[model samples]
Target: VQESEIGTAPDKTSTAFIPKQNEQNVLNDILSSLHLTPMDVYAADNTCAAGSKLTERHTFFPPFLNSSVARTKTLVHISELSKLHSAKRVVSDETFQDLCDSIESTGIYLYTPIYDSVNPRMPLPLRYECRQFPRASGYVEDPATGIAAAALACSLRKHNQRYFETNNDIVPHHEHTNSYDRFEFYQGTAMGRPSKITIRFVENKDQHCDDTTAVKRTTTRMLCSGLV
Candidate 1:
């Protein structure tokens, strides 16, 4: 994952672009191909309901494929990762092939972020499932995907903007430093080669003089770490 991390220098942190997908038909097509109803895909932090149209689209380039198209990573809040694992086994090969052909992404990445405990202050951990369609290359289910992890991090920030702003008490902060959030993605478990990707990001920071609040500028820095 993330270009094998070995014998490679990490790239600089870059801005994450958050786009909107207003095409209802596109979302429907993707869900139809996987034999998954809209209920299978929901937003993180319970920001959106099942079967609702989510306009935010999170995309990123696969570090291994610089010349390839951007991959779209989606958050699937279907209660548990076991449900997705079962669905993946039942989907037809033809359906997956058609999905890859119809979509710009080379694969479909779905993940669920669940809180390990009932405490609200605890961090959320993610369980990822990635299916590389046969049409793009071969029908392979990757054990781990760094691209999806990065995209999901950005998506979570965007979807939880309100919660982050209003719930400042729960936001992790430090003296003489900007407040930030951390996310851990657990992947490859279904295939037995489990891995964990950790992402830490710093959000907007503003400064003011003479008791006047300055203009708000968003600064997002994403740092990723993982085990093979």
Candidate 2:
């Protein structure tokens, strides 16, 4: 399942899959212990993988904390946050800002740019996923994403506000104004999003897409003017 379209790909055998033992149990344990599923802790335990030993040396894991944390929100499938579901879940700037903060902690990004801006009837979706692996690792594709640039924009604003107690927040609306036919995200500081990307079925590889090119691609730039 790791290599399939639906799978979280990890070529190396040592990589952590779902947490060991009862994957659901750890989620329940941490969530129940704090009476809240703070995104950072949840993500930490998630990447920790139940069986994987907690190591301070490792890049992903950390030592025990002194106090419990709480988040006043429910975790939803990332798919639920799409434009298609915006009418129902329209997250406010505050929530979106938190999302950006939570995202930076994980170092993953999921960005969907609105394609076909001129025609409302012909809205096209762009899937920006492709990377030329990283140093110390051979060419490989990451399984999860967190749409870095936008998320960072959101996080930077919030973190700045929280840290300095600034009244002037980072304006989410400012991210717009550019014709973003391409997306540069977390796969790497070196990661590159081509003009168009294609995912073929069965085979695990990129098929330079044609349909994407034909469509007038435009991205959805959400401005965090205020709460939802």
lDDT agreement with native, every candidate: 0.46, 0.25
Query: Can you write out model 2's per-residue Cα lDDT over 1-228, one digit (the tens) per residue?
Result: 000011121222322223333333533333232222323222212332212321111212111111101111121112112321121213343443433243222211223223233532221122222221111112232322223233323332233334333333232121222212222222222233323222111213333448555434443333322110
What is the total number of backbone clashes in candidate 1? 0
| lDDT (Cα, 0-100) at 197 in candidate 1 | 77
TM-score of each: 0.56, 0.19
Candidate 2, residue 156: how far the Cα is off, in Å: 1.9
Candidate 1 Cα misplacement greater than 4 A, ranges: 1-29, 32-35, 43-70, 89-95, 101-103, 118-135, 166-169, 172-180, 202-219
Estimate, for each residue in 1-228, the C-alpha lDDT of model 1 and write its tens digit: 112110111122322111124534554555566556554543222232221112121111211111121364333334345555554533566766665454444566656545324343333232334332223444456666776677656555543554445545354444422234566677777677778777677666775545655666667677888986
Best by TM-score: 1
Best candidate per lDDT, number?
A: 1
- Minimum summed lDDT over a 10-residue window in model 2 is located at 61-70
